[model samples]
Target: MAFHLRPATDQDLPFARALTYEAMSGYYLQYGLMWSNDGFDVAWAGRENWLICNDNAVLGFISLSRDSRALYIRELHMLEACRGLGAGSWVLEQMALKAQALGVLRLTVFKNNPARRLYLRSGMRIVGEEHCFWRMERVCQSS
Candidate 1:
């Protein structure tokens, strides 16, 4: 089945946060960083978030923030069953299309996170690093 995206609602925040913790806690642990939910509500309320779905089921969610220079991919978390199914790559492509005017699509991934492979495969290159994260970006061809 093909996955689709829908705008995230307040009801989706719990699922998003749970999936984020499930997907990211290991990385945080490995990097010796704490996983904090302190401001997730405030941050989610302020960003553009979407739920990735297939049929009637949500597979994951993505969060985005934009500025003059680029569209930032704040979060992309999928259920374990959805991983390796091309959903991440598809989301990156969609984000790239949305970012054409800005000319850049950027995200940060944990230094040793396996999802780095997905970003690389989707045309994102590591341009720099900050602490335990790798800053990656894909330059979009503006129309």
Candidate 2:
């Protein structure tokens, strides 16, 4: 199924937080870190968020922030049942398009997150490493 993205609203917080926790809680536990939704509201209010939807079904959400040099993907989470169906790739394509004029698109993913493979397939390369995550970037091709 094809998906569409719409600007997120206040009502999406609970859904977005739940989806994020579902996708990352395991990584947090594996890395000996605690998962908390503590500053989600404050951060959410400061970034641009979009809900990934297929008609009336909400499949996931993507959060982003940008600087003159790059568009950073702060978060991208899809429902477990909704993965492996091209949504993540589709989102990446959309983000890349959004970043075309920005020069680059970047994100950080847990070192062992399976999504890293998807990022790699989508043309993102690891440029740096943190204690537990890989910082990746895809340089956009200007048309």
Candidate 3:
């Protein structure tokens, strides 16, 4: 199936928020926590959220915050049905390409996130850890 990854527009915000809930609720619920719609509302309004979709529906999503030197990936979630496929890796590749095009030197991922494996596999490495989150950096390779 053909899929596209693109910057989300305002019209996609509601779907994005619902996708966030679908992806995160399981994890949060494990810790007896849940995300409030108000919080998602605020995040959706403020962050750069990207959506992954095919002809059918949104398959995954990721959000990031960037500065002059780096982009911090705030959230990356693929639908339960899409896990174990290449969707997650595709999203990471897209993010790396975007970072490179923007001259960004690094991107960070949280410590316990399983997606850390994907980031590491894509050539990002741990540079530091704080407050239980690992910070990974992708140094541009010299060709």
Candidate 4:
């Protein structure tokens, strides 16, 4: 399904947060990774959150921010049923386009998360690692 990005509103925060937990909680547990299972950071979902939506509803959310030298992707997640449907790839592609010419695009993926492969396939390279996460970056050529 084709999806578009829009700034997430306050009303959408709960749905986005729940979807993120549903999509990721198990993976984190399975990997024995420490996570915020205790609660969520609603404040962090403010302006930077972007909803991946189609006609019916939101499929997921992604968060981004930037400095003069780099665009940072905080999270990119999809609902369980939405996986393998190419929506994540599409989101990342759009993110790359959004970040291009801004400077390097950077993100961290759980070392065990399959999305690292999607990042790699999108031309992002693993640049470093910390704990159980891998720092990846894609350098967009300046025009």
User: Top TM-score: which candidate number?
Assistant: 2
> What's model 1's TM-score?
0.95
Candidate 4 lands at a TM-score of: 0.85
* Weakest lDDT window of 10 consecutive positions for candidate 3: 101-110
Candidate 1 global CA lDDT score? 0.91
Once superposed on the true structure, which residue ranges of model 3 sit more than 4 Å away at CA?
26-34, 105-110, 141-143
Per-residue lDDT of 1-143 in model 4, one digit per residue for the tens?
A: 66888888778767867776776788788778555733456445433888887766777888787889888888788877777878888887787787877868899888888888889998999999998889999987657
Which regions of candidate 4 are displaced past 4 Å?
27-34, 37-39, 42-47
Query: Candidate 2 on 1-143: residue-level lDDT in tens?
Result: 87899999999999999989888889988999987787777778899999998988888999999999999999999999988888899999999999999999999999999999999999999999999999999999778
Q: TM-score ranking from best to worst?
A: 2, 1, 4, 3
Candidate with more favorable, higher TM-score: 1 or 4: 1
Tens-place lDDT per residue, model 1, 21-133, is: 88888888888888778577788999999999888888899999999999999999989998878888888899999999999999999988989998998999999999999
For model 3, how big is the CA root-mean-square deviation? 2.9
Q: How close is candidate 2 to the true structure, as a TM-score?
A: 0.96
- On lDDT, the stronger of 2 and 3 is 2
Encode model 3's per-residue lDDT on 1-143: one tens digit a residue: 67787778888777777877876666566656658989877877888888887766888777888887766677787877888778877777777777775554455544566778888887788888766567787765334
Candidate 2 colliding pairs: none
